[model samples]
Target: MKQRGGAYDPFDCKHYPEADVVMRPGMPLAMACTGEKARIVMLAGGRGMHQRLTSMGLGVGSEIEIIRRGSPGPFLIATGNTRLAIGAAMAHKIMVIPMEREIE
Candidate 1:
């Protein structure tokens, strides 16, 4: 049985091996093309950054659709019913697996 609010380590790919079996390997969010949908796999940042993103519903396992890709500006992404614009540098720290393909 799973414990609620226990030591949940979302970064452990072993616990979420289905992500790899169904989708491609992870890639930086900034590298994903515009209009692509992907699931967040990892976040490479400190506590504050994690809190900021989590507050905006961008934590690991969240599915996001890229609305626009900004090379030198903030990138627009849609998560749930909310749309967020994050800076390029920040987006680069988020690793995600594209959901555009599925393995049979």
Candidate 2:
């Protein structure tokens, strides 16, 4: 709900509906899924935000991926290219979609 950047009112996203966010597979994510873990190839934020995100292991080139959504909610996530477990509360702060896997 909080818009990290000033491009839009921070409060606007709070009211934004889930359906509005685009979730095309392989496309860059516009927002975090309610219960899907998304691999974070990069993070978009300034200093303070960056620091906070880093605490959650969300940083540039970290490569966090969505595993699955929990029965209650928030979805299980894999963090870093290392692939650690993370909860949805932390994922919500991130705005991401999906990326097409690179062909080896």
Candidate 3:
């Protein structure tokens, strides 16, 4: 196939009328995209970590938005009207499913 400017398309891609890309399954909170909303799928941590997160309203099934995916520091997330900064390790322990739209 040829693209604009008369450049040959090596892949020979064909345009589809209603092609949609599906998102992958749940991923770690630390790897979630900033500004994206997701639901807590699971927490990989034990009692202590679980309690700590739950106290901050990040329990399982909670819907959260990634405010900042801190690589070397902490992950800033929002749940309800509260915003909390969780450590990188803790963020990695939280598994979340990215949502296409916010849940009410």
Candidate 4:
């Protein structure tokens, strides 16, 4: 994956190279399924995008849950006690590592 600006730690994301990053370890938050929990790993945008996400309490390492999946409008996500409706376009700029659910 060709990220714009964000820290890339091998330990955090594993052995996927920059070119192949989009295939494994992490994926765009927009692609994540509803009800899934994910951790923000990278912001594939410039400083402005980073600042915007940060102001919304969404940054690297932040754990979030997908509340609603959106095909046209904004999608909803919950972080801590806050629920945010992020635009589809902005969601594409946020890369996340989807956490696997434990079998009960």
Best-performing candidate as measured by lDDT: 4
Summing lDDT over every window of 10 consecutive residues in candidate 3, give the lowest-scoring window: 16-25
Clashes of each: 0, 9, 0, 2
Give a tens-digit lDDT track for model 4, residues 39-99.
9888888999999999999999899999998899898999999999999999998989887
Query: How does candidate 1 score on lDDT?
Result: 0.85
Q: Which structure is stronger by lDDT: 1 or 3?
A: 1
lDDT of 3 by residue, 1-104 (tens): 55856885544545522222233336889889989999998888899999998788788899999998897888889998999999999888898988884355
The Cα local distance difference test for each model comes to: 0.85, 0.51, 0.81, 0.85
Candidate 4 displacement at residue 57 in angstroms: 0.5
Candidate 4 weakest ten by summed lDDT: 1-10
Ranking by lDDT: 4, 1, 3, 2
Cα displacement (Å) at residue 87, model 3: 0.5
Arranged by TM-score with the best first, the candidates are: 4, 1, 3, 2
List candidate 2 stretches off by more than 4 Å: 1-52, 80-85, 101-104
Which portions of model 3 show Cα errors greater than 4 Å? 1-25, 101-104
TM-score of each model, in listed order: 0.72, 0.39, 0.71, 0.73
Candidate 1 lDDT over 1-104, as tens digits, reads: 24447865444556567554465448889999999999998887799999999898789889999999988889999998999998999888898988876344
Give each prediction's root-mean-square deviation over alpha carbons: 10.0, 9.2, 10.4, 8.3
- Number of residue pairs clashing in candidate 4, backbone atoms closer than 3 angstroms, sequence gap of 3 or more or interchain: 2
Candidate 3 residue 20 Cα shift, in angstroms, is: 31
